[model samples]
Target: MNTSHQTATVSSKDGATPPAPRTRRRRNVAVVAALTGILGAMGTLVYFAVPLYQLFCQVTGFGGTTQVAAKAPGAVPGRVVTVRFDTNVARDMPWQFSPPAPVEVRLGEERLVAFAAQNTGNEPMLGTATFNVTPFKVARYFNKIECFCFTEQLLMPGERKEFPVTFFVDPAIADDPNAGDVTAITLSYTFYNKGAAALDEYLNRSRATAGRAVPREMNQ
Candidate 1:
């Protein structure tokens, strides 16, 4: 006599019931929906990159973004702070920018400093500057009364101009325990060309559609 045995395939080795076809279908749909949502959020992220970065810096005084003020309150005795200057020009800017040499000032003492720029290119160009201060924690106390940054600067070929900034360190900085060790700050500016003739339109629309193209929940 010959004996034969067959091994049967079960849904699971442990004998747990398999999910029904409908249940499996629902899981597949959920997985696809999650992937779709993630892809959509990635697309929206690029749109918010630039403006969001600037806003974050400005709000938290991160990245050394400085503040604007009308004038210094008054000079504080025995509170002299060293302020260094730095300048940079974008490769395509075709302009020269050199901040004045470093200077020392008493807290709350209003001081005027000039940053000069000259067009080195043979053609007219429009350039603007972006500035920040370091240590970033001191940015709140570093106020600028006049600045050339963030403005449409038009220069004819070989044209030279002097832009000045009236600024001061607020005496209140002395009261902040976190800033007690801050004795110096460096103010730096970088100039770049945003193209010609469209400066106004570019700036006007830079933040115009900030929230329009992005959904409220995508960032969350």
Candidate 2:
């Protein structure tokens, strides 16, 4: 009887259960939570990053804006008129502008205008420009087919470059009562320097050394 009792006590002690199953469940839950959090963060980043970057580029002129360069096909031909080109850079930007010699073109024929931009300051300046027809109404008939302002320009100090724009007035304008009477159109350019964040410190230092005031138009 004593031996049987001792045997029974030893059996009970050896039967102590381990917590292996519970531990495994807790570890699995933790891993799943971690994965969920990481995926959520990645998704959130993707959602906001692209659009924010695009908006920043547009406002800062890091990426050039879309502009129409050519007139619509099949426009009516009208009397030739002389057009003028004007360019304005920010005051802080050290640059020079030269207007193209005026030329006469018929209403439907394409005309090309040229301008010379020179970096007068000591530092390299990088900027983008956009062109528009003044008086807004004339824009309907004035068409530009090729323009350098469509892209960003990197000008080294003392560098001079001639940019050309080819454009024409839509012949159709001659038929429209609102546009038919218009004889002259003005093409204007507004330029801005890329923000410091988009430009490197070396370039920024160059711009500062140049010590030019920001241009009035770029203040907008």
Candidate 3:
């Protein structure tokens, strides 16, 4: 009987696993899978971080970003506000951009502003403009009706063109406690070149044409 009991004890020690240990291992696996899935989702969010943030800013005017509207506000207010214009070009873009100076208008009144762009490059170039308002706190109250920024611009060598932007300050801005003290808003634009490939193609064509020119010996 003693020998039989000894054999049973050895069998239990060698062949039997505690149910609690098996359960703990399964729980650990589930937790690891859950963490992996959460990390994957986080990675996807990080991948689209820039564009998603931009869209959020556009929708909510979270930054100094302004709003785009289909029409002007319903009523023009008696309060007058000054809008100053500013312009810039990206370093690689071979174009000149200019916006008119300041103008004052009643709040909720639609105003038309023009900007001039000239392509000083030897080849055709394309550009896209982005704009923002200063004193970012009031940006949500600014609305754009028609803006050249909605489209890409293409200009030939030495070509100059004027682009128009129509916009207004929402009348509700006067009522907003945060924006009541604002008197002037600066509208700024920066143009980015969108035609690098076009410029390269133009250069290649010019080089090919030059290769066919009369040799110096022939001219002599």
Candidate 4:
């Protein structure tokens, strides 16, 4: 009887030990599976992050996109006239701006107006611009055929660069009776730093505060 009891206890202990190994094996497998899943997710995210960001940029115009400004309610196209270009920097910004002495063209003709942008600031400035027409209402009639504002300008201290823009007024505006008598159109430009990180932060902050996404292609 003593032998039989001892034999039964040993058998129970042995059975318990086997189960422990199986449990350990299952735990190990689970750990490996979890780790694999995490790594795969990370790899997928890394692969798609850049392209997703670019798509976001294209859709939001975060960089810049062509846009038409506000137009006069009753504006009609008039005789094709040359629209002039000019630029100005804030007092703190040591920059120089010069547009063509006399930018001229017929109403429907596209002309490239050139400007000399000089960085007079002591520090290097990354320049990006947002432009709008002086008379907001004429934007519908005034069209930019080519513009440098679509790209960023990296200016070193004391750097001078020539920026040009090709634009025209819609001749159809002259014929539109609703368009009020429009004489001169002025295109205005505002410059900002083109640093992507800074721009992203600024935009994000603006969106948070305003509760609206800032137009990415606003100035361009």
RMSD for each of the candidates:
12.2, 13.7, 11.7, 15.1
Off by over 4 Å in 4: 1-78, 194-220
Best by TM-score: 1
lDDT of 4 by residue, 4-105 (tens): 999889989888543587888999999999999999999999999999877877667686653543332332344545466667665556678776765655
**Cα lDDT, model 2, residue 192:** 77
Question: For this target, which candidate reaches the highest lDDT against the unseen true structure?
Answer: 3
Cα lDDT tens digits for candidate 1, 1-220: 1222221244345577768999999999999999999998997888898999999887787887764476689888997899999999998877888789889999999999998999988987778889999999989888888888888787789999999989999899999999999888999999889785565565457556765557754866
After aligning candidate 1 to the native by TM-score, how far in Å is the CA of 99 from where it should be?
0.8
Each prediction's Cα lDDT score? 0.85, 0.76, 0.86, 0.70
**CA lDDT of 114 in candidate 3?**
92
How much is the lDDT of residue 116 in candidate 2?
83
Quick one: ranking by TM-score, best first?
1, 3, 2, 4
- Between prediction 3 and prediction 4, the one with superior TM-score is 3
Better of 1 and 4 by lDDT: 1
Better of 2 and 4 by TM-score: 2
Query: What is the C-alpha lDDT profile of model 3 across 70-136, one tens digit per residue?
Result: 7776657478889999999999888989888799988888888899999998878878888899899
* CA error at residue 176 for candidate 1, angstroms: 1.0
TM-score of each: 0.60, 0.56, 0.58, 0.51
Candidate order, lDDT descending: 3, 1, 2, 4
